[model samples]
Target: MSAIQALSRQLYQSKLPWTFEFNFNEPDYIEQYWTHLGGDLTFNRPINMMSLPSHFIHEPLPGASATLATISHQQALQYMSAQHLQQSFLLSVHQYLMQNIQNNIQLEHTAEHFQMSSATLKRKLKKHQTHFQAQLDQSRLHTAIHLYRVHGFKTEQISQYLQINDTTNFRRAFKRWSGLTVQAAQS
Candidate 1:
């Protein structure tokens, strides 16, 4: 089962209303849930409806028992397909970076990681209409946004994680990727 489906199943098994903040329709809903959970967790980032399904299993009812349940096979297949695509994109980007971002690193390392020649990798990326730099920039932007918003990390830390020299470029690039500044992106 996909993360979201597993979460939904856990929610149903707990016999609790699927609830928590980040309900896209209600800005204040998540804060209240965090309060009820006796902690200060917050979905400080801008909430989107598509992200809701991922959290359903996280808020379990107290005094509830877990149960094994089944979902429709067709729905399961569809969920798995979407999940596989997401995982593939994430893993490829991650592995590509891991093998290519060391000192004097090169694209040839990324191609080697994929067990293909650099030329083949280039051709495949062209067919997809994307380049490695674009994907790397996107991955960095996504990670920076998440860390800054969710963990309240500073710009310097974010830049460091992205393996960039300075925070200024990180800030400028972040603002370009996300309309909000890093400071503003939090909450």
Candidate 2:
């Protein structure tokens, strides 16, 4: 479904861990099968939801309407595969940026690292509706958030990690990115 594909794309872009919730009274044979297949199954929850670590592919159960379920499963598979491919492309860009966060990464440098011309890389990113600087800022914002919230890093430490010479600028940027002050985000 388009809805599933959109959610998958969003999850892939965010690169956040999540848990799946299912609404079932008990663990049925079908649930056990999915669990054996490495699916995280949480039953008797208030809602039915799927979590995507990176463009998750939902597998249909065996015990469903043969005709309708088959059609739906095929459609879902197609969407999932397509979304996975798109996410892979974006991941390549983001990974390169994050890995070289300490260095002053430029488009040409990144393109050379990836073995492509800068123009070509730009075109590819354009196709994805993102540019290098945007990705860089997003990666930094996520890292800063994690360091501050998870690792309990102070604002000055986070600013140094992000290569922002001024803690004030980092604070302003964090507020703009998350709509929360540094103290608020930490809390």
Candidate 3:
């Protein structure tokens, strides 16, 4: 969220003195945060919302940004575009893997789902400094962590939910993923 605010500031530097409006999915904002936002603090967020996405928006006054912001604008655009491409692929892969966590994961099937050959998927992931296994491990580890710590699920339950088929195997896999025993991890 701070990244979004800073990016908005740079992108709208030409329109300095712009009014900032924030809509947070969280119920409240810290008053300290308003000091850095550099605009009027007006609250127009939804009420009684359980889940929503937060937004950092800049509302320039009338006739603001009449001139170009130039270097900052160009740099911001370049950064955003590069980040979008690189992160989009990884995010897509993670989302797909997460949704099918209970199933046996396979690189070939994942490649097919992405409409590409297995080798092509491997190449793309390598370019991003990762491979299929790392992504899969990350997804599994996160799910395991959440289930174990947050939901207080037993090892057997987690193993069954993740379809690992055996409690001992799940324990070993969990140790490998997190470098800690399940009980130790909870502590």
Candidate 4:
């Protein structure tokens, strides 16, 4: 396998979030190759690196020359660590929303925190196949599940924690998310 293919496989198998950086300019064929394998590519100017989510299928690029560069194992590990720290921007935004789930999370608030305009944030999320409200619903559902299962919180408590005004709405939303009523989930 080529280096990029091998690296992509390793990252996917490890199940850790990562961003791949290529030193040379990514030819159009390379981009197409990755895209066909369900990878999203973001090009960085001056750096010649392509950032993508970790869960991508790697296919060999047609007519690609295999140029192997020998590197120490420790250097490879360090490179992997750096890549893990550079997760997709959309994921970082989701994580930020998850951390602030107790408060009323808003797109404007998240955008300001990320130092991007609200439109830019929306565009980025859209590129990643999600929207602000969708992410909020996901975060709330995740938090609700954790509180319900781990802390034994009741529906009312979860609703309050999530800042939902009505427990009935919370129940409905929870059922929609998990296909089970809160009480049903608890039992």
- At residue 125, candidate 1 shows an lDDT of 74
What lDDT tens digits, residue by residue, belong to model 4 across residues 1-187?
1356556556445433334433245666875646543344333221223334433336443434444323455677789898875767867876998899988788899999999999999998889898998888777877886786557788889999988889999988877765667776554
Pairs of colliding residues, candidate 2: none
Residue-level lDDT of model 3, residues 70-163, one tens digit each, is: 7668888899888874548999999999999989989999999999999999999999999999899878987887686557888889999999
76-129 per-residue lDDT for model 1 (tens digits): 778889887455544675666754443334568777877889898778777777
- Tell me the TM-score of model 4: 0.55
Cα-based lDDT for every prediction: 0.58, 0.69, 0.70, 0.68
Shift in Å, residue 58, candidate 3:
29
**Cα displacement (Å) at residue 108, model 2:** 1.9
Candidate achieving higher TM-score, 1 or 4 = 4
Q: Which 10 consecutive residues of model 3 have the lowest summed lDDT?
A: 45-54
Per-residue error (Å), model 3, residue 158: 0.5
lDDT of 2 by residue, 39-125 (tens): 555655433555545343454333446898789989988998988745477898888788887777788999899899999988988
Q: State, as a TM-score between 0 and 1, how close model 1 is to the true structure.
A: 0.53
